[model samples]
Target: MPQMLLIVEPIGQRAERGRADGEAVYQRMLDFAAELQAEGLLLGVNSLGSAAKRLAKRDGGAQVWDGPFAEAKEMVGGYFLLDTEDEGVAMAWAERCPAAEWATVEIRGVGPCYM
Candidate 1:
């Protein structure tokens, strides 16, 4: 099994940090990723930009919307995919994540949607 660590952050949080602070925080994340890679636990990692698009099909029509969505209080800042079968190990890594200091590290198992 694989687990994903979603870095959920409040909207505008990055802007509040400003460029310098943001860069510093990002460096910390990179260092963390390197540690995971060294441990052979990291499968993939990426930081998400604020810009996003939402698409939906309704009534036989496709609708699309561009964000920053006003209704959303939080956004996914990044993700880390870990190769592991133990949920406990994933949870431990999530706790060690740099984002855990300023954001929510959501741990979710990789599985079929139907499951």
Candidate 2:
């Protein structure tokens, strides 16, 4: 099965509020994940730490930069790895994501995670 990477770019004040909300965003995500799991579309989910630790190799050499501070309004807050053949279907799933309504969810290829 082809794998689709759901780059969950969480944003907005609501997201910040969500962080403090008991279950946090998990409460919202769980429902969505359940739906996907029911359809056998979801594979895995992960939340990244503050971007502050992000390293970079910009240009042809290594150049470290400060992180945890994202310039984009929609920051890459988390990710959901889905196993699906139809990208459209995956997109449909992304549409229902709560973040998209208030923020954004970037759907991209998972690339080589094992690499």
Candidate 3:
């Protein structure tokens, strides 16, 4: 099984931190990823940009919206996919994530939607 750690952060939080602070925080996350990789637990990782697009179908028509969306209070800042079968191990890793210090770290199991 695989687990995903989603980094959820408030909108504009990165900007508030400014470039220097943001880079420092990002370096911490990179270090964390390196540790996970060294432990053979990291499957993949990536930081997400706030710029996004939303698509929907309405009455057989395609609708597209570009963000920053007005209704969004939070955004997914990043994700870490870990190769693990134990949920406890995943939870433990989530607890150790650098993002947990300032953002929400959401743990999720990777599987088909029907499941």
Candidate 4:
């Protein structure tokens, strides 16, 4: 089966709302995940921490930068792995996501890889 990955991005007022309504948001996600699981559409789900780090190579050496405060338009807050046959259906699921009302849900098809 084809898989769709939903990447959740929260920015600006959305980010603030996520913090202010953390528990409610968490419950909403839980409910959404449960619905997907009941429909056999969800494979897995995870929420990311605010702490983030950037790895870079500067003049042949390694550099590490810490952030939850990067000057970026949005931060990746969570993700869901979904099993589905059609891209349109996967997109529809994303549209139904609770975060869709306040955040951006980016849908991407999972590609196959060979070793």
Note the Cα lDDT for every prediction shown. Answer: 0.97, 0.66, 0.96, 0.78
Per-residue lDDT of candidate 1, residues 1-115 (tens digit): 6999999999999999999999999999999999999999999999999999999999999999999999999999999999997999999999999999999999999989987
Least accurate 10 contiguous residues by lDDT in model 1: 106-115
Stretches of candidate 4 above 4 Å error?
Answer: 5-7, 11-15, 18-20, 57-60, 112-115
Ranking by lDDT: 1, 3, 4, 2
Q: Where does candidate 3 stray beyond 4 Å?
A: none
Q: What tens-digit string does per-residue lDDT give for candidate 4 at 1-81?
A: 565555557555445666658788789999999999999888889987767899989899998888856587677888888
Q: How many angstroms is residue 108 displaced in model 4 relative to the true structure, after the best TM-score fit?
A: 0.5
Task: List model 3 lDDT by residue over 1-115, tens digit each.
Answer: 6999999999999999999999999999999999999999999999999999999998999999999999999999999999997889999999999999999999999988998
Q: In model 3, what is the error at residue 40, expressed in angstroms?
A: 0.5
Q: List TM-scores for all candidates, in order.
A: 0.97, 0.68, 0.97, 0.79
- TM-score winner, 3 or 4: 3
- Write the residue-wise lDDT of candidate 2 on 1-115 in tens digits: 4555445454554445655672656578877778778888778877655445556686788766675456655556667778876778778888888657555677776656764
| Model 2, position 34: C-alpha lDDT score | 81
Judge candidate 2 at residue 4 and give its lDDT: 54
lDDT for position 63 in model 4: 84
